[model samples]
Structure formats: structure tokens, C-alpha cells
Target: MDTTLLHQYQLVLSSREALLNYCETIRPEHLAQPIPSYNNDSMGSLMRHVANTYLGWLLNFLQQEQHPYFTEDNHKNLPAIRSMFEQVNLVVNNFLQQYKDDLTAPLNLPREGETKLTLTPLELFTHVITHEYHHKGQLANMSRQLGYIPVDTDVIRD
Candidate 1:
């Protein structure tokens, strides 16, 4: 694998692991505590959404294997959320490995309306990485608001 692509995938995987570790520190009861000003998505829901984003994008957009995204409330609990993140990490990790050499191959994906967008595997993979990193920022903020410190998910850290 190219160093750059491997690094990108590593950051995504590490981000998921960081989130799982963060979940371990949270009180189960506080999993669903929502910051009203932030939005209706609680910590648990946000975690679930992050996992679902990986599944849905890979499946529906990137032509990967089909699997149901665990978006229901029951699957958004602390333990389940952690598991969902693992599942997502596994799928994406596999996808990245299997498609490493095809990174620049354009994908035939559709847009929301009648438009079409062709993206390289590299772009799709990057979207999944950036998407998780984006949520990790929100998760960090949410953690601080809830009186807990989120794991440092920065790709480069001491």
C-alpha cells in the first residue's frame, strides 16, 4: 500500500478505536444525554450515525456488500454503539485494503437528484475518513459539555 493511502486508512481506523475507547469512559446512563443547543442527536445517536455513514456510503454509494445500518434507538446504546463502530471499521478497513490499487479508478455513483457524480475510490475513501473526523470534532465538543474528555483522535499525536 502507498504510504499516503495507508496513512489515510490508519487514521480512519484509529479514529474508530479512539471513539470506542471514549465510550468506555462514559457512564452508560449518560449515553443519551443530549445538548439541546447542539441538536437532537445525543452522544449515542451521533456515534450510531457515524457508524451508519460508513455502512451506507460504502454499500449504497461505493458498491460494497449490502448490510443494514444500525440506526435504531436500541442499537445506539453505549455498548452497541461501540460494537457498531468496530463493525464499521472492519468493513472500511477491508475495503481500503482490497481497493488500494484501484484508488484512482472512477466510480459510477449517483447524486441525490437526477445528477451524477463520478468519484475515484480515493475520493470515496477520503470522504469516509473526513466524515468520521468531522464527527469526532462534534463528539469532542459534546464530551466536554457532558463533563468528560474525548480521546485524542488526531492522526499525529504524542
Candidate 2:
């Protein structure tokens, strides 16, 4: 992997830590409360979904055993969600190490419907990180709707 990409990912992790730390200040119940407009998803569910996307794409490329997405009932709390992301981090590290020599080599996957899916390691990494940040925004909005003011979770902040 390029050192630049690794550095960028570290920045993303910094922002994620900021966001999770802020999430800890939210009411425990709010994390589990379903917000109907966002597909009735609770904040916890969105977090799990983000982790799942990382696992789904990267693990598939690694040809590693994959697990189903975490259930809201089982991982709706802060500690459990944090732990899930820990595992996600491990998987991400393994993926980067495995493809460090050639990040842009195409990885062809089993077809979905009529179209086969193909992506480079870099593309997969980019997708999962961006997906996390996208839903991180949603989590912030959910916190606002639940009556808590969100803090700055941007990649670079003063």
C-alpha cells in the first residue's frame, strides 16, 4: 500500500475515534431508538452496517471466512459497537498487508445478477472508508434529532 494512502486512512481513524467518543456522550437509549425516516434504523444499526460493508468487501477479496452483519439487539450498546469496529480494523489491516505489493490489481468476484463485480484493493479500501464517513454524518444527524448537539468529527480539525 502507498504510504500516502496509509496516512490518509490513519486520519480517517482519528476522525472516527472523535466521532465515537462524541457518541459516548449521547444517551444510551438514543443509540437504540429507531429513527423512522432513516429506514427506521437506530444509530447503532447504521454503525454496524458500516462495519459490515468493510467486512463484506475486503474479506471477500481475501477469500476469508465471512460472518453475517451484527444484529442491533446484540450490538446496540457503545461497548459492543466499539468492539465490532476493532475487529473491522484487524480485517482492514490484513487486507492492506495482503495487497501491499499491488493495490491496483483487479480482483474479480462472483457475478451479482447479470453483472460481475470487479475492483482493485484501493477501490475497496476507498469504498469502505467513504461509506463509514457517509454514515458517520447520518449518525451525527441522528444524534441531533435525539436532542444532543454533535461535536466536530471532521478528518482535520483545529
Mark the 10 consecutive residues where model 1 has the least summed lDDT: 71-80
Error of 2 at 56 (Å): 0.9
| Candidate closest to the true structure, highest TM-score | 2
Q: Point out where model 1 deviates above 4 Å.
A: 1-4, 64-66, 73-75
lDDT of 2 by residue, 11-90 (tens): 88899999989988988889999998899899988898998888788774345565666676546799998999898888
User: Top model by lDDT, which number?
Assistant: 2
Clashing pairs in 2: 1-100
TM-score of 1: 0.84
- The lDDT values for all models are 0.75, 0.84
Give the residue spans of candidate 2 off by over 4 A.
61-64
Backbone clashes for every candidate come to 0, 1
